[model samples]
Structures are given as structure tokens and as C-alpha cells.
Target: MEIDDLTPAETRVWRAFATGTPVDFRATDDEDPSDGGAWGAERTVRAHVLRALLLDGPRAEGEVPALNLAGVRVTGVLELQYATVDHPLRLRHCHFEDVPRLYGARLREVNLSESVLPGLISHAVRVEGVLRLTRARFAGMVRLGGAEVTGSLYLESTRIQAPDTEGPVLQLNQAVLGADLWAPGLVARGEVRLDGARVAGTVNLTDAVLDRPGGTALKAETLAAESDVLLRDAEVLGRLELRGARIPGRLDLSHARLANPGGTALRASSCVIGELWLRQGPMVEGVLNLRRTQVDVLFLEPEVVPAWVQLNDLTYTSLIPHEPAERRLPMLEKGDSYLPFVYEQLTASYRRIGDDDAARSVQLAKQRRYRRTLPWYGRLWGHLQDVTVGYGFRPLRAGGWLLSLLAVGSAAYGLHHPPPLKPAESPDFNPVFYTLDLLLPVISFGQENAFAPEGGYQTLAYVLIITGWILATTVIAGLTRTVSRQ
Candidate 1:
């Protein structure tokens, strides 16, 4: 391992290291000097280049390093652990045919820009300082689980290819970051898992595109952020779960395309935030489950209307199986101004479930909530006062005009035909038929007791007078007085 007894190329590489100059394979325009003739011949020059960096000490600053392994064939593990670099580490146009390990490596103030890292494994990679990947592309699978970073982690315009499984393309499970995590314009062909990851600052995924199948586009849980969890204009082909995450500031999913097979659930249970905006892209296929999620000020805080109002637009085709009604109502109620919208959506959902009563109840509750805001002639206007003293009560209104017409017709018939007088011997009036007799007019064609002609005419005259008085009273009452209490 002595520098003096090494080969000429190795001596030159050592000299470049000592002199703080650039050490790149492309600089020499030949294969790495470490790849001897007796060792594996098919081994790639890039492998030797990586081996030199791993085994070597700290690299000097301002080194124009480049490792172009565009088509190099490799079959073994490429370890680059504990390597410190002050300059940018360029692996542009490189292709890893197999999985490569770079675990526990400290990439401090380095740039891996415009590189293609296929199947790169960086498990437990402690990035203490800033690591920039402006336009790097990842072809196969990549794992960044349990990685911790103290500085800003920038991945702007990065592309991550989808893996064959239903899992995420880039898994950042249980990772912790001390600074802001920026990934604007980041495109992922597969899902992204950041479950239990904690970021002290904002977790920005603005303009990021995440495309996947029926699986979730982002599966993050317990993500505690001090600032906003910004996902503005981020397109998610599958569900986006922020379940059990705590966001101190706003949770902005504005203008994001969130597509789920049935629906998407942005469950942020037990989390506190200022606002939750589902206002941008509301054409969600499923319910936006915010079960037990707590918001401080505003919920369903939409930036615009009509275009971003699809929480209740789900049809019967999107209905799922039965869930507990009590449990579901709270989730729908968590959003502030969107409570009405949520209730409306839930009503539709309940209707799809064949629970019409529940749906009606939800509608009634909404009406009651905004009853005071209604016009003076509205149905709920003065509802409470009307209930207290029986004001504005109208049973006839319920029966409509048909009952009134019937009452009028009965009165007309009674006026035309007066009831007959009972015999003088019969003193008592039959109480059962008395009301009916009063209502109908009895027409007399001939006189009774013809033997007494004077008496019959006199009785007929009295009867006519009495009938006239009764008819007049009935007409006056029917016209002047109201029939029944509502």
C-alpha cells in the first residue's frame, strides 16, 4: 500500500491526490491502472475507479472528477463506503448492470448531477452536508432507507424509474432530515415511500410527477414537519397517504392530480395544521379520508371553485363497501368550510349504500346549519318561533286545495236540500244523525197530515223559514272563517 513502490499510473493518481488535483478516469483516456492483467479481465474500469476512491482517503477540493461507466460490464458488488469528497462526484452516463452498495458513505458538499445511477443502493447513507442531484436519472431500483441528512437535500429534476413490484420506486423509510427537502420537478415512474420520515423544515415536492398503478404514489406516515408539507402541482397516479403525519403549518395539495382506483385518502390523523387545501384538483376517484385529523383554522381551503370541487362528485360506480357510520362522519367533519361539502359527499355515498334516511339526515343538518342565512320567505325562516307557538301552522296547506274544494261542494248541496222536520210526538233529536241532517237539505214534494190542511201549510211555511236561516248561516261561516289548524 506504499505510494513509492506503486505502478506509474497509481503513483500519478497518488500525486494528484497529494497535489489536490482532479482524479478522473476520463482524464487519463485509458482503463484504471489498478485493473491488472492477471485479475478479472472482464471487470469494468469504473469498478477500479470506485475502488480507488473507497480505499483512498479524503479527496481534495476543486477536483474535476468524472467516472463515465456508460456501458461497462460489472457482476460483483461496488462498495463506496466512508469516502469523503470536497469536489463534485460525477458519474454521468453510467450504467450499473447489477445492484451497487454505497452504504454509510458521507457525501458532503458534492454534486452527482446528470448521472444515471441504475440500481444504486445507498442504505444508511449519512449525508451530513449538502448533496445536489440536479438532473440525475435512476433506472432500476434504489433504496435510501434509514438515511439521515443534516443539510439541504436537493433532487430537482430527478427521474426515478419504476420497479417491477407494487412497492415504491424510492423508499425513504424512517429517514430524518434537518433541513428543507426540495424535490421540485422530480418524476417517479413508481410509488415513493417516506414512511415515518421526519423533516425539521418544509417537505417540498412541488411540480413532482409520481406515476404508478393501483398502488399508492406516496406512502408517508408519521412525517413530522415544522413547516408546510407542500405538494403543489404534484401529480400522483395512485393514492397519497399522509396518514398519522404531523404538519405544523399548512398541508397544501393544491393543483395536484391525485388519482386512486376508487378514491384517495389523505389521512392525517392526530396531525395539527393551519389549513388543508384539496382545492386545486378535486376530481378524486375516492373519498379523501381525513379521519381524526385536526386542523387549526381552515379546512377544504380551496384556492378556486367549481374546478376544484369533486369531493362529492363521486358516482355510484365509485362506491365502496360499508364502513362504520360513526367513524366515517368524524373524518368528513374534520375539514372546516368543507364540512358541508364533505357532508354532501357523504350523503351521496350513503345514498349509494342504500341508506336514504342517513342521506336525508345529512341534508337536513346542512339546511339547519345555514338556516339563518336563508331569505325571509325560505322554508326554515322563523322555524323555531313557529314551532314554539304554533304560528304559521297550516294543515290545509299539507292537504292542498282539494280539501277546500270538497268543503265548498258539501256546503252548496246542503243549501239546495234542507233536512225534514221530525214528528211532533218525537221530542228527542237523534244525536248521531243530527249533524248529517243539518248538513243535507230535505225537499218535501207533498204535505204530511193532509187531514189537517191548515196545519200542514203552516208547518211547511215554518220549515221553509228555518231552512233558509240555516243555509244562510252555513254560507256565511264557510266564506268568513278558516277551516282547520295546520
Candidate 2:
């Protein structure tokens, strides 16, 4: 690939690109056969012009001189399909007549910053260096599916407009990025697909705005990121899907606004993350679903409220600092059956750190929520047992009941002096033995039945018998529950 071998047109392109001299051609003069957009519109450079100037030799290694084609208006599908470039392509401030076709191409770097194009189809393209599309405007779909970039994929301030709501504006499934995938200030009309993508650094989408109202704005299932997935101050008009995604760092949703009324706004089910920070400035109109997500920490700040927060099967190791029980409890008040399990999860999280007091409070909170789910009569019964015996969780309270009843019966026998009808030579008022005989329903100590009651003692005897039966039933039920637990 020497300069002497170039054609007349190729030499002209090389003179402008290689020598840093400006070249202008009539874009409307020749109609390229490979036009991918704007039907019948004439283009500037032919498909082979820029390709001949930018293509690097197959064996070319290490860094070569960068091809600076800034502000150039290239024509029909700047097709560089499988050509390997050893140097970076700096096409900043350029206006493409159609989409660039870099599919399966190997490049050192590709920078199209501040450029205007119909679309970009570069799937399976391998870039050894960065790919910059900063502030670039796309009128159609931008497909970079399965592309592998050794460096970052910078799309900051980029605006993509795809009229089709069903299709994605940007597709990057399984695209591996060694550095950050910077899309801050990006505005996409269709879905932004990052499913199965792996980013070694952060997926920085901070302040990005995505608008796809009836459907998903972002689909990022099975995405694995080593650093944070920052959506700070960003806004999404539809659902943000992150199902089965793995982020070792925080998924910071601080100051983010999500709107998808009656449907799930943010679905992060089965995701494994370090922490999920829903700060006070965040707001979600629809459900914030975290079903089966395994997060080590959940840092929920005050004033962050979603229409519904579905935390079913969510497992977290701890609550972050300043996220007290009172503050976090209201977030679980979605008025659903999952409320009890959310409290249970909080209890388990606290117990994992040996915070039994916090665990107990969570248990009490769980019981309170459980009571809310019951019918009126069931609630009454639950409240009775909670005050007296803590719903069989407190077995020792049953002992308290027995002791109090025994003491009261004994005092009644000692003070009233109920006349005994036994022929034995015993004291007329044996309060201790008589009370024990009355309390133990299954075993008779020959003290209760051997004596006949007199005056109001008959009514007292009936009360003791009924109390004994009730206490026996409660003790048996508690023991059964404890044994079943084991």
C-alpha cells in the first residue's frame, strides 16, 4: 500500500488527509450506489475514496500517524468493513452523507465526535483503542452489537434519534469495554440495549436522559460491570431493565427520575451488586422492582419514594449508615404480602451482624405488618397473643402466665379459707399444694379433688380449671411450634 500505487482520486484524498490540506468535493454531483440513507441524495466522496486513504496494512503494528479527517463531509456508507487500521481515526466535526459501515473492522481508535450521521453499524468491530462519539447526532439506529473495545466507549453529550419505538437507538449486547462506557448527557429516543455487556470500569451514564415512554428506555440484562453504574441526575421516561446484571460497585440512582406509571419503572431482578443507593433526590413513578437481587448493602435515603417498591426475594447483608429502622420501614409499606418478608429480610440482615436488638425490632415490625394482613377477628387474636405471649415466639411468657395464675389461686385459698371435705388430717388451707393441683390439669396431686369447695370457692375452683386448660393448650402449641422450627 504505497503512495505511488494510489489512483488519481485516491491520491487527491490522500493529499487532503495525509498533508492536512482541506479538500471539498460536490456532495450532490455523484450518486453513490451504496447509499444507506437519504434516498437519491448525492454524496461528496465516493465509498472507496476515504477507505483508500485511511486503510492500514495488515502487518502494520504499533502506533502510526493518526488520520485527522475533521470537518470532512464524506459520502455513501464510509465502508471500511474488514480493513485494519494501526492509527486512530479522528473524524471530529464531520457530517456523513450516510451511515458508516465498520462491521468486523479492526481499528486502533475511531473518534467521530461532534459528527452528524444517519446511523452507525459497527457490530463485531474490534477497536484496540477508544471509540469516541461525543456530541454526535444520529438520525437512525446506532448498532454496535458484540463490538469489543480495549479502551473506553465515549458517547458523552451524544443525541440519538430513532423513530421506531420498538427498536433500540443503541445496541451493544456483549460488547466488552476495558475502560468506562461514558454516556453522560446522552439523549436516546429508543431503547439503549447493553445486554450481556462487560465493562471493566464504570458505566457512567450520569445526567443522561432517555425517552421511550411506552416501552423500555434501557435494557441491560446480564451486564457485568466492575465499577459503579451511575445514573445520577439522569431521567428515564420508561422502564429501565437490569435483570441478572452484576455490578461489584454501587448502582447509584441518586437524583434520577424514572417514570412508568402502573408498570415497572426499574427492574433489577436477580442482579448481584455491592450496594443499591436510592438517595433522597431519586424519584420513581412506577414500581422499583428488586426481586431476587443479591445486594450487600441497601442505602435508602429519606424522601426517596416510588409508587411501589417490590423487594420480593431480595437479599441484602446490611443497611447503610443513617438508614435507621424508622426511615427504611416506610419503604416496605407497599401494602402487599411481600411486606412481611421484607421485614424478615431486614431482621436477617441485622442478625447477620449480631445486632439482636435491631433484629427484635424488625421482628416486631414484621408481626405488626402480619397483623395488618389478617381479618378483624384474626387481628384481635394476634394482638391478644402478642401482648401476652408474643405469638408463641415467647415461650417463657407461658411460664409467666402459670406463675401468676398459681399465685392468685393460692392467695384466694389462703384468704377465703374454703372448707375442706376430706377426712385426712391436713391443714384447712393448704394454698400451695391446692393451687398446684388445680394448675396441673393432666396430673392430679390428690389435693384438688379430695376437697369439696364451700361458698364462693366453687366459682373460684371453676376459674382455676378453665385457666389450667387454656395454659395447657398454649404451652403445647408453643412447644409444637418450637420443635417444628428445629
Which model scores highest in lDDT?
Answer: 2
What's each prediction's TM-score?
0.57, 0.77
Error of 1 at 59 (Å): 8.0
Error of 1 at 184 (Å): 0.9
lDDT of 2 by residue, 380-458 (tens): 8677666555655676787898789889988888887666676675445578779888888988766786677776878
RMSD of each: 14.1, 6.5
Note the Cα lDDT for every prediction shown.
0.56, 0.78
Best by TM-score: 2
Native-referenced Cα lDDT, model 2:
0.78
What's the number of clashes in each of the models?
7, 0
Q: List the lowest-lDDT window of 10 residues for candidate 2.
A: 33-42
lDDT tens digits, residue span 367-400, model 1: 4445545687764433532232112122223233
Residue 281 in model 1: lDDT: 71
